[model samples]
Target: MSQVVFELQGKADAIKTESTLSAFIKNYPVLNGYTKRDFNLAPYWKIPTRKKEKISFETINITDSLKNGASFDDVLTSLEKGINRPFKNRKEHVAFCLITKGEKSYLAMTFDHLVFDARNAETFLDIFQEDFKGKKYDGSLNLKEPAHLSMWMEKFKAGQRVNRAFLKMADKIPPRVLPLSSGRKGFKFKILTFSKKESEAIAENAFSQAGYLMLMPYALSASVSAMHEIFAGRGDSGNYVIPVSIDTRKKEEVRRQFFFSNTSFFIFKVEAGLAARFPELLNSVKEQMYSQVKADLPGDICRASLLMRIAPPSILGSLLKIYLKGQIASFSFSYVGETAYESPYFMDNKIINMFHMPRVPVPPGIGIFFQKSKENLNVILSHLDGMLTDEESKKILSLLKSRLGVE
Candidate 1:
């Protein structure tokens, strides 16, 4: 809930893109987010009018003239700088950095995850582009909530449901996890973008193999299988506990719930042996998914989260650490399904591609994300630095590519 990223790659005039981006962010919903230490349950934001100079645009020209901009170890080094750089203060929460090489440009936005989730990031882009094209961004930026201070009994019951679910998980052997490397902790990304045909094949395979409307289960199955191979190779064996985050916002809710994070998790426990069999694994994943849906587990999670908001963040953090016993999950997973920023253009630039770089905390320190844009599936593997060996990383990615039924 600290910083999250959204990256845009496309053709645009470097100088023009910078100026346009600066203007776009100036008017975004988040200017400078502040959380006063007054112990308030409901977070308050300082969405003040913007200052052109207070917000800075960092341009890393890979063309080799800029210094901190110039002598970067590589693109990833510069990118990590852009992503992990702490906000100047509570008065600042978002940072935009542009990386240019000859005619290509990559625009990155790092914003406070407390205020924006992955979906919020995409909607941010779409809104900005709409504004750039003279069609004002007409999003329902409704920031009002009931404070959720009432309904004690309901909240208690919701908590009980969530607790029971996790407790059940606790009854099993701890999931296999990759031990944290004591190495310096920056993140590295391996991104694979499938072509239109490959994306089509994945959807078709999802239907044929997992069943109708089961793309997510199919994708999750592939991810579990990918990680299982590495663990199997290492002779590590145990059930895999993966918490899959799903967007809680429905189709109609996107317009109203467009500001904050709207996501919840479906915890899946797959036995190691089951992951080796794709068909059986897909069935198991789907079974867990459907049963959870039938039980409205995600809904209970969303309601339970509101109750959690009353606790001070520090206490909440402590309780989380204690409850999980320092092992959160086998890894993190999510499927954003479709692109929110599906437009073909941004400002006057052609919108070539869009993807998200979401971090997984150190306990897990690994996440597999899937997003579809322009009929292509973008698979993003985000993990902490030094967590996976070079060969292991390549093999995991290869396994994902092969597992997804892509070439």
Candidate 2:
């Protein structure tokens, strides 16, 4: 995961301030148990039981260069470049870069997804904020155990049932061919945002008409419309199948253990006919989503993680790769709603804005992430490199903007 956090400061604060951010970074729990790689045991692979010996942390300061009035984009771009470069070693899984220009500063953090998911990442931020405020760190919570083989097999059997149900549903409605971009290679990402007023308006409109408070209906509908427009000339009108990610932190067992990587995917299908109108399409999507949630599809998937303990990594990895390449055309994740960090200031530096973008893997080609901080809504577009030409990417962005009523 990657994030861009802006620090608002004044000239006096900038001149006098020594970073309070470092303390939070240094004091964070090692969480070494979560960093272990899969171990080979002949025909099967097992998750390591032992925690890593050490955790390395580094912070780079670019305040001198940014003093010339660099834009946030410039700082973000630089930080991204640094993140893309190879790390010195395995222990270097987390790092921070600080950029400052007079009173304003930007802090970027890049973390390996193996150690953090979107929800847990927010939890880490809360911990950091508390530490910055001189609050005591809580160490009583225990880390969740990784799913074992028995747990996975049970869930796998349940997931099989869910898949069977999904297959039956697909037969009733002809599956839509998602107009996915072909011949994509590396990954690429883009970010778009809506102001507090605009985000509120969009949420209000969606809720009033569709009885849905989330902006996903609007976002998904817009994406479907845009893809349909892009592929209409090609006669590719098929049903859309989107695998939406569900955060499992709300689960009693998961929450109790402080599970850091608790997430599951549920397939959301919408007929091509309903894709034209926002409200109807939103309702259709919402119904399917709610049905799966009620059925505990995400929980089943979470339990299925036990497969890691029973299956050989090579075979399991290949199967998953094939599924990602052929089954789904797009993915969506939302981190909208309330956040724990309420204050705009962290230590002496004011926070200008903060947003996170999950890394997108290939085969699906495109990922859309939505995060709401206070009233501001941020949209992150991550896709495989070469998935869409420059013009195609921009056109899709324009379509989403229009759909969301964002200028």
lDDT against the true structure, each candidate: 0.73, 0.57
Evaluated against the true structure, the overall lDDT of model 1 is 0.73
Model 2 regions more than 4 Å off: 7-72, 101-103, 144-147, 151-153, 165-186, 231-237, 248-259, 313-327
What lDDT is reached at residue 390 by model 2? 65
Q: What's model 1's lDDT at 74? A: 62
**What tens digits encode model 1's per-residue C-alpha lDDT throughout 1-407?**
33233334454565776777776766653556555423554645555565645365687767666554443236556777766566777676677777765555667777767777777677777777777778885556676566676887887788788788877766344578887776475677777778888889989998998888788999999999999988777776467888898773544566566666777778888888798999899889988888888988888877877776657656644554454555678888988856666568666656566667776766688889887776678887888878788788878889998998886
Clashing pairs in 1: 66-70
Candidate 2: tens digits of C-alpha lDDT, residues 1-407: 54445445643232222345444444444433233344442121222445433333334444546356555556556655644555455544555555655466655566666556665666666556677677765556664453354444577787686556455445333344434555333445666768878888778766776565555656666666766565554566456667676553442333344324556677777676776777788778778778877987777666654555445546644554344434444344444344434567655666666676555654465667776666677777766556566676677777877876665
Instruction: Tally clashing residue pairs in candidate 1.
Output: 1
Model 1 weakest 10-residue run by lDDT: 1-10
